[model samples]
Structures are given as structure tokens and as C-alpha cells.
Target: MVKYFSNDVDIRTTWDLVVSAFWQRYPNPFSGHVLTEDVVFREVTADQRLLSRRLLTKTNRMPRWAEFLFPANLSRSVYIVEDSIVNLVTKSLTTYTWNLNHTTLMSVKERCVFQESEGRPSLTRLRREAWISSGVYGFSRPIQEFGLARFKSNQVKAMKGLEFALSNLQGLRLTVAERRHGVSPASKTQ
Candidate 1:
């Protein structure tokens, strides 16, 4: 069985800042399961859009009830491939990500778009979609249900991580601005 999920959220920030935070989202407190990220390919297209592919390694922690179903050889880590495009002209970013292993057990794919909110210029909107499926014989339904639940939980963390990164980026920029003006940190009013 396959399950689909979709959600939309407005981030109280500009699109440019959201995009910047996206690239620096790792190492945040909420995303400790994300082990490593490597850029496999990156280029600026003729139309000035940034295109990139990345490989990410993430810990795959199975629910205790489902652990017995998986084979012993199955690794505890999952490999995911992410492809993204940043279109400067449109002021938007889009990304697609999917796992490359253990498809027969379960598969999850996600796509997200980040753009400025139509009604609120200061806010950025994120539209996210996900598909979850399982090929396990009699356990497909249960496995798919589990996948969907886990996906939702992880997405919440993902957003928090992005917000954490954005907060840090803003702080760093402010510090730089203060330094450029020869203002001492201690002199600034909190």
C-alpha cells in the first residue's frame, strides 16, 4: 500500500534567508539523526539557476516491533539522494529526495518548494509532499503506516532545524554589521 502526505507552512522570514538556511540546516540540535551530507554535483545553469545533487547518510532506527522482520545484513544507515534547484529569477527553491536502499521493506520520497508567500511578503511558504510505500508481503499496510508516522515526526524536526539555522545566520550577520561599524558587543543594548 502507498500513502501520501502533504503540508504547507509559512515561515516568518524572507525567501532569500530561507534558502540560505536550507543549505546550513545541518548540525542543528533537532537533526542529530542526519549523519553526513556530501555534495555530489553542483553547477550554475545557463539560466542562472543553481542545480545540485547531494548524498546524505542518515541513521535508520527501526521500531522495536519491526526490527525482527528485517534481515541481519540490512545496515542501520540509509543513503538518500537529493536533487535541488534554486531559481533566482523565480526566487524559489525546490528539492526532491528519496532513499536508495531497502526499497522492498519501505520507501519514502519527499519534495519541497520554498517561495515567498503571496499575501505576506515578509513570510516564506513551504509546500511539502511525501509518498510512503512498502513492498513487504503481508506487512505492507502496517509498514506503510509506520513510515508515514515517522515521516511526519521527522518533518517537524526538519523545520525546527531550519529555524535554528536561520536564527544563527541572522545573529552572525548582525555581529558582522556591528563589527563593521566599530561597535563593541558590550555596548549594544539587549
Candidate 2:
């Protein structure tokens, strides 16, 4: 299955700590992009029922204030972030497993397809086909190197944002390469 490393930390408590630290103000400036409101806040279980009411009163299609306040359950942790460049919506979820050590793992799965009102098919058909054909492999060497380099460059600033939440938690060790299993039949002949 999916391979992930364990970190010695309490997943839930760490998550709460991190959220509280970063969500006080909107991370990115709302310049050029259309924002309905000036500020947003973190949502907890207590704010679930008020979501529809808030939505009804807001002028923006989806207000950032209400968006962040939505309750995250086991299935869906976060909703799609507002992006002005693309017309599609994107969302992400993260899960933690408590075992020998508390392991915090995150997977980002995104779709950029919009549904048709008349019940037409989605635009992800091409992406799905390419994925099935194994066209998209693991991250490229350049991509990996760039990611690590960026992380290193911003380590101090990044940690400042996450330290409170992750103070007791250790980062999960990540594999540099993606593991592949079962060779293609065509390669067997070679």
C-alpha cells in the first residue's frame, strides 16, 4: 500500500496547535484576487450548523471566513482553497495513524474538472487515462532537488509557522524516490 514514516507526536493536538498558530490572519494577500470579506477564522465543530446561514448572508460566492470555519470530519478535513487563476476547485485532506510512533501523513489529490449542468462527463478523462497507462511516474530528480532546496532555504521561516503545533512532534521521514512494483510485460523480453 502507501508507505509512510512515523513521527513521535500526538496527531490531533499537534494539528490543533498548528492551525491556531497560522489561521489568525489570511496567509496570502487578497490583491488582484476577488475576496468577499477582509478576514477569516478557523472553524471548529461548534460552527457546523451556522455554515448555511453564513453562506446565505455573504455576497461572495464563498466567503473565506465561512470556508475556514467549516467543520472537518474524519472523511473530509479541508475544503478547496480559492484560486483566481484556475476556474476549477481543489481540496486536500490529511490523516494520522497512531502506532509505534504517532505518524502524520498527508496526501494531496486534486482535480481541475468542472461538471456540466446537463450531466456531461468530466474533463479528468485524459488525466485518468494517462495515469492508468503509467505515464506519470514519481517526482523527477529536478523536482525533488528543488523541493528539498526550497525547504532548506525556508526552514527557519517555515518552522516558525509550524513550531507551536509541531513542537513535540517529529517530522515523518520521506523517501526520496517512489517505489515501483511489477515490471511491464514489454520490459520482460529485454
Local distance difference test, each candidate? 0.94, 0.25
Q: For candidate 1, what is the total of clashing residue pairs? A: 0
Residue-pair clashes per candidate: 0, 1
| Predicted candidate 1 versus true structure: per-residue lDDT over 35-145, tens digit per residue | 999999999989999999999999999999887887767798999999999998888899999999988888999999998888787999999999999888999999999
**Which 10-residue window of candidate 2 scores lowest in summed lDDT?**
125-134
Distance (Å) between predicted and true CA of 136, model 2? Answer: 11
Indicate the worst ten consecutive residues by lDDT in candidate 1. 65-74
Q: State the local distance difference test value for candidate 2.
A: 0.25
- Model 2 regions lying over 4 Å from their true place: 1-18, 25-139, 162-190
Off by over 4 Å in 1: none
Best candidate (score: TM-score)? 1
